[model samples]
Target: MPRSFLAVSLIALALAGCVTKPRPPSHLGATVTVAPPSKADVWQRVASAADAARIARIGSAWSEGLAEARSRGFGDEVKKEALLLRSGAALARPAPTPGSYSCRMVEIGSTPKKKVAFERFKPFFCYVEVEGELLTIVKQTGSQRPAGRLWEDDVASRLVYLGSLALGEEDQPKAYGEDPARDMAGVVERVAPFVWRLVIPYPRNGAKLDVFELTPVTEQPK
Candidate 1:
């Protein structure tokens, strides 16, 4: 062959050799083994001992107020005032010994209000160590707004503790006059091993009381 033809043939062969082979496609249906997260990895530390104790006291007072209100069949105004007094006293008293707790978001209870869905709320389950205090803090979750933004701009309470008790007021929509913005209390009773019931008096007079039946997130289907 001519020198130019020979050079062109050699270049073509080198280019063919340099071309990379195509890789096989990955298996779309293949099972992926993801190790479950370790307890340390999943548990989040959100509050210190002092903070937890203060919150607990506030919650306890609220719970007590609710119980009293229900027993007396008090009106809305009476219940609200009672809660205020209880919460104030709780704060003024000497702080109790601080306790430690590990908290994680759990399931919320169902509600009739169409605007508010319990599933959307990311409530917390706190396993406490200060004299065996266990409580749950129910708060709205999955909001597009930035962190630190208040849920619905309403200052209602949602702290429920063991011993069939809870401290926190129910949230009333804006359509209703201002949210009570008070610390209320109620009962947290265990219906089953993993199932719990939360009962709180309705903030509005003559309205039906609120009841929440909650279960762990692990029990929910994927």
Candidate 2:
């Protein structure tokens, strides 16, 4: 592994997060101290066997998601954001700094027999927090938020996200496996300078791919 990537990744905290906890200030630029991971990788240790299996097929999800989106007439739009939509556009140093971020969601490809192929949601606020040797990215705004941790992978350019949705304003997010219906899985990759995206492929909801673009915010909501 490259020294720069390894330095950032080795300290990335992984696992799920809750809304009520008093987490540290996740501001950007400070180096965090992390306990070394055990012999088994973090994802392999924490992810449910079934979800792990699904994430393993992320490659297929991207392939099919793009194909269906184009078939449904979103080819032009998909082509427009090639960097964010492309499956292999991941850059190095997938570890994200702990901080508040501006997040936007865009969906591509409709499920079979569905006509709603492309969709975009207004930008929202998300947060990245670290605890132990893992990092959690959770949508700080929006009633329906996905929260999960980033785990290292052999692929090098991306980290696996295993988390669940926090429905409503007060409901705590179910852990990645507590509720099979709400489980969410994806890959977190840096697509550009200080910008990262979480791509949830083969999603069970509105579309095939749920792409969320995340950029750190200088000012956070009070």
Best by lDDT: 2
- Model 1, span 127-195: residue lDDT tens: 212323322333322221101101110122333321222223424212111222323234343444444
Candidate 2, superposed: residue stretches over 4 Å from native: 1-41
For candidate 2, report its TM-score: 0.77
Off by over 4 Å in 1: 1-134, 140-180, 219-222
- The clash numbers for all candidates, in the given order, read 5, 5
Candidate 1 clashes between residue pairs 3 or more apart in a chain or in different chains: 62-185, 63-185, 157-169, 164-188, 165-188
lDDT measured at residue 49 in model 1 versus the true structure, 0 to 100: 37
TM-scores vs. true structure, each candidate: 0.25, 0.77
lDDT of 2 by residue, 67-131 (tens): 87788788998888778888888999998999999999988777666777888789999999997
Whole-model lDDT for model 1 versus the true structure?
A: 0.33
Q: Look at candidate 2 and tell me the lDDT of residue 89.
A: 84
